[model samples]
Target: MTNLGKWTARLAVIVILVLAFVAMLWWDPRPHFERVRQDHVVHFVVFYALMLSLVLSLPKLPVWAIAISLFALSVLLEFVQPYFGRECSLSDILTNLITVAVATFPIWIGKTIRPSDN
Candidate 1:
C-alpha cells in the first residue's frame, strides 16, 4: 500500500474507535444489573484496544505521550457522565488507566530490550 493509503486507513480506524468510545461511555443503555459484574472487564478490553490502535496509528509520536493522552481522555469522559445520564465512577478511571498501562507496558519493555533501529 502507498503511504497515503496506509495513513487514510489508520485515520478511518481511529475515527471509528473514538466514536465507539464516546457512544459506549456516554450513551450506553444497558441495564445496571448486566454491567455490575462485567463493567471493569469491558472497560479494560476497550481501552486496551484503543491504546494499541492509537500507538499503531500514530507511530511518530512517543508511546508515553499516547498513553498519557488516553488517560486524560478517559478521565474527562468519566467525569462528564453525569450530565449524560450516567454516573461517573472512579473505578472506571482506574480501570482505564490500568488498561493503558497493561497495553503499553510490553511495548515499552520490548523497546528497552531490542532498542528499535529507528
Candidate 2:
C-alpha cells in the first residue's frame, strides 16, 4: 500500500472504533432498532461489511493475521459488552467469526479487487 492508503486505512480503523463506541456504549432515547440489531442476518451483514472495510483499509496485512486479529477483537468486545449494560452471547461470537470468514471470500479467491489509486 502507498503512504496515502496506509493513512486512509488507519483513519478508517479510527472511524470503525468510533462507530463501535457509539453503537455499543452510548445510550440514547432514539429508536434502537432492537430487532435488526439482534437478528443473525444483521450480524452477518454488518460484520461482513466491517471485516471487508478492515481488509480494505489494511490490505498489506496477511489475511490470516487479519482474521485472527478480528476474532480476538470480537471476543474482547463481547467481554466488554457486559459492562455497558448489554448482554453478551456465544451466538454473537459465532456469528461474528462466520461472517468474517464469509466476508473474506473475495480475498481468499485470488488477488484482491482493489480500486485504482491513480
Candidate 3:
C-alpha cells in the first residue's frame, strides 16, 4: 500500500482502539464476573494487547513516538476514568508498558536482522 493509505489505516485503528477503551471504562464487566481481581487483570491484558497491536501495526512510526503516545494515552485514560465511575491504577500503566515492550521486541529483532542498505 501507499504511505498515505498505510497512515490512514493506522489512524483508523487508533481511533477504534480509543473508542473501545472508553466503552470499556463506561461499561465494566466486573459485576458480572464475580471475581474482581481476576477480571481486572483480564481486562488489563486484553487492553494492553490491543494497544500493543496498534503500536506494532505502524511499522513506519518511530519507536519513541509510539512509546510516548502509549504512555500519554494511558495517562489520558486514567484521568478520564473517574467520569465513568472507574478507578485507575499504576499497575495498569505498568502492564501496558510491559506489553508494549514485548510487542516491540519483534520489530527490533527484524530491524537488526535486516539492516537497511542506506
Q: Pick the candidate with the highest lDDT.
A: 1
* Candidate 1: RMSD to truth: 4.5
Can you write out model 1's per-residue Cα lDDT over 9-107, one digit (the tens) per residue?
688667768765764675345537666647777787678878878776776789999999999999999889899888888888999999999989997
lDDT of 1: 0.80
Candidate 2 residue 94 C-alpha distance from true site, Å: 0.3
For model 1, the superposed segments whose C-alpha errors exceed 4 Å read: 1-34, 115-118
Q: Highest TM-score among the candidates is held by which one?
A: 1
Q: State every prediction's TM-score relative to the real structure.
A: 0.71, 0.61, 0.57
C-alpha lDDT (0 to 100) for residue 29 of candidate 3: 51
State the lDDT at 63 in candidate 1.
94
- Badly placed stretches (over 4 Å) of model 2 are 1-38, 112-118
Per residue, candidate 3 scores C-alpha lDDT tens digits across 3-100 of 99778767766776776566566545534546555545655655555655565486667766776687778778878877888777676667666666
Q: Which residue pairs overlap in candidate 1's backbone?
A: none
lDDT of 3: 0.65
Cα RMSD for candidates in order: 4.5, 5.6, 5.3
Global lDDT of each candidate: 0.80, 0.70, 0.65
